[model samples]
Target: MIVRRCVGLLALPLLLGCCVVHAAPPRGFDVLHYSVALVPDIAAKRVQGQQTVRFKAEQALSTLTLDAGTLEVTSVTQHGRALAFAQAGQQLHITLATPLQRGASAELQIRYHGAPAFGLTFAPEREEVYTLFSTSQWMPSVDAPDERATLDLAVTLPPALLAAGTGRALPTRTLADGRIEHRWRLDTPMPGYVYGFAAGRYQQATQQHGPVQLRYLSVERSPAQLRTVFARTGDMLDFFAERAGLPYRGDYQQALVASTIGQEMAGLSLMSEAYGQDVLDDADQIALMAHEAAHHWWGNRVTCAGWEHFWLNEGMANFMTAAYLQQAQGEAAYQAQVDGWRTRLDALRAKGADHALVYADWDAPTADDRAVVYRKGAYVLHLLRGELGDAVFWRGLRAYTVANDGRSVVTADFQRAMETAAGHSLQPFFDEWVYTAGTAAQ
Candidate 1:
């Protein structure tokens, strides 16, 4: 069996007292970065875009950085006036002719055009491509999970293509020669990855779940197949609300793009077409959808303190989604699925890479580290739930969400909240799952 190694938690104990590691908490809502346009042509295998970012340095600093990837600048301007800038690798360096003090807002107008390979992940076997904005491309910001902010995007696309994104579309504008522009605004603050767009000829179907309206869009040819695949979205949402004690938020929507990636954002999710057709069907589909949907609470609302604790997001969402599926599908299926994942974890452990789960080692993570973060993280939550009991576990999760909404948190924060809900301390569990190098027996 092939297994992947985990990182982050395993290195914690060794580094104790060597250096203090703490992610900064949100001071206040500070910046408004507008992604004005994205234009991609698949046939050419390239993408180009521009951004109009407006930001305020809450405090004066000698050094500041924004998360940006490998991109080329065509032009730069400040407040409608031209400015000169330099680049050092992926960092875009701009100097103010005069020092700008704190509490000062500025508009940066940058025109960039590049082939953002990060946005387009291709799967050769399936002949599909997944597109999403990873900070490794054109734009820059504090490219960390702790820096959750709002985004307003207007995407321009060829007339033949349709797009699905996290925000609501205001209207579509037509350019002179037939290209179209779609304006979307996300009022709520979200992590950057959540606000992604996929453009293709797609079909959409809508349904209402209690107080929330839901929609599922997919490539047009597979409308019937998609309907069959995502049939349980409503039921899964209802199950999650009752079991997890948190309702699905915003305009709940999901779409299967012409790619092989699936992620949950605040109100919308993108699933790759192959994933939708292959792995997403029947009970498995419910489990995957529930996994993404629960992120509406775990990942979207209360984000991780930083990418280092991504397991905090992935683990909780995985466990909660499994919990919902258990309620809806029954214990045997849940246990079976858990065992299936446990097998994956065991393989990783045997390969000696299980230590990645407990170490904050994401500097240059390999594919193995990614698997550990997702699957092993889920196992950690499962162990925690076993110790806390069902009522305490669910109540603790609900309370955690209530206390930390619109904020990011770390292992200590989660433990404190859960301990309060359980009416007892959970230091042992945190230590074993988050700071130790080995997995607790499943």
Candidate 2:
């Protein structure tokens, strides 16, 4: 999160409204891995890359397509042999010379050059660069949140700057052209939307919390401020792990850049310089940080089956921030946070702008629709906690999270977990609150 990935859904008009920008992946195979090597021209805002995709076909197939937003494909090859390819609209149609049969596997190396339309920034003035959303904009690949695969990134940049990304950082090497290539690998499978990178001249500080490595980086703020602002990093991790009964064993990082982006990748989180300043002003401005950190459990680990149940990711994260407040900042602070959500929910209700937390279509959403996902969704959790005793509510959450770790889930999956803990059906409660425009006033 950094800014909590609502994306300018309020201020800007989006066709998909923070939903899937990636089209449905071609229907024959599952993507197993992606090896992306990129050379970004910071001054020109142009990038060139070689994308190697490995997949296994479930059925016999001779052609496939990938969502390649405005990329100009130069070549497509298998091993050393060329494959026929064409760029149509936002898709790259690749025709396999050697057709894949049922249960067969193949790899395609696609070379492309283009200026990214969105999701990546190259601020040459400040000498910083980062990605926000739309992984397809930066790399020509599927951006669906449910499509999971391993990744390897090789970003070539100047030797002096640093690079932080989605996976474990491997050794850096000097390319023949004199630029330094930063390499990273994600051995575990994660959706492409969580694949990203950030590179700049940053002052990095690292610490170890249990088995997890906690790294903090900043370009504008002093190293002391970087540590000061993220001092609660380890505590948030401990709180979430304790609450979920699942420890985060991987490395984590928070890098401050120019934009107000708080988007989380697999292991790296890009925060904004503005938020760091806010933390400097008030050390207790940790709610936003807490919300993003909570995504490590709800959003990134146990993803929504689809964007339709995205509240399972965002609403749960928002409510967990309040839960952390209840623990760290006292019950009054937690009640105040809940009261703020109530205010927002009441406002939405007043405007007749309330929408179901479990929305059906993400066609075009108003800012209030987005608010319902964050505020009303959290309020419903507060209501659910009230209905089920504290012990049962927490037990249900632990059951749901532990059972669906590293898996995709829908709203019903959560409802069943709560019902199991309560030893009774909560279907009536969900039918009234979650399935409809929430009961904000009641």
Candidate 3:
């Protein structure tokens, strides 16, 4: 997500910058996969969907719950039989007909429909529909970054509209009602938040790199204009792959939508059309470009274990964006980005709003708080690079990504990787910058 930072004061302190205050994670079962079928009535701003949750129990269980946000679950079933269930506030409780023994697997089908108040967009005037964030708000599923699941999605929308989503596209089917069922299958497990789709009357183009397909979709940009704005995507992907030591996996899509905002999903990104125009007018408008594209490797793949260590996601992406800028643009562009981050922290510190990079809570985070995660997080990486030199730093990053690829990570895991690569302790550096709120040491 691309949010502009502002000035404000918020005082918070943490122990070693690693305490996170979220609800206790659901135990006893891990969601294995989600098979969903959805139909959206764009003109009415309403949608209905059937969601099937497959899970494996780690302990004996009679019931399970999912974070269901304002969705009216019509029924719950196992196999072909109806099961008892309840919808309380933001949770969906399903009672297993037979006690699910330890290690047993089960599937619960959730049929639902509602006009989502958020996380989904229905642009009738613009003739487009897309999802923004909080996957639970639109679909019933676990919304934890640590718990990942595969997805098989089938969306029924107007025949005239074009659509794109996570994973690879399957053959489309037209129903008797004349609506088309566009399907996608994501074999790799991913956090639910990044699983989404966008459909509209778009002018699009494709670029192929190896087995991965690169797609560009826009509501307004001509095919030539789309190329002009996002011309460097291939280079950016190549740069990230070389530095992280992990080839960018899966197909990638960039869709410029009707609003003025930027966000990313597992294999797709929704960028504002306004920003696309800005890029056409200015060549240096690459920060947002690099930032969002970097998420494929940083935030989405090598994920943070908890929100407290969120800097591992955004900070890494931000810093990698700077690195990409240095390679593609110049040394001055990279220094300018670092200096800009420093300036934000300086201003934030002047207001007494700065805190340790990791905090206990993110409930209603202020702009000053984001500066710590997005800027200071990136700043420390820049400092770490300076301390370890290019060889050790890049090696550490590769070691970390290769070891923890497709796994949740904490700051300690990162420090351990760097220490192993450096053949010494990095405790003092982390304590000063990451665990304590102070100026970045030269």
Best by lDDT: 3
Off by over 4 Å in 2: 1-26
lDDT values, one for every candidate: 0.65, 0.81, 0.84
Looking at model 2, residue 166 earns an lDDT score of 88
- Candidate order by TM-score, decreasing, is 3, 2, 1
- TM-score for candidate 3: 0.94
lDDT-sorted candidate list, best first = 3, 2, 1
Clashes of each: 15, 4, 0
- Give the per-residue lDDT of model 3 (tens digit) for 1-442: 7433111112244666343333324467999999999898899998899988999998999888787777889998888899999888677888999998888898888899988877778889877889886677778887667778999999998888999998889999999999899999999888887889999999999888777788999989998898888888888899999988999988889999988467778889888889999999997797887888898888888887666677998999999999999998899999998998889888888888888876755545678888889998999999999999999999999999989889888788898999999999987788778887866434
Flag regions of model 3 displaced more than 4 Å: 2-14, 17-26, 440-442
lDDT of 1 at 228: 71
Candidate 2, after superposition: displacement of residue 202 in Å? Answer: 0.8
Q: CA shift at 394, candidate 2, in angstroms?
A: 1.1
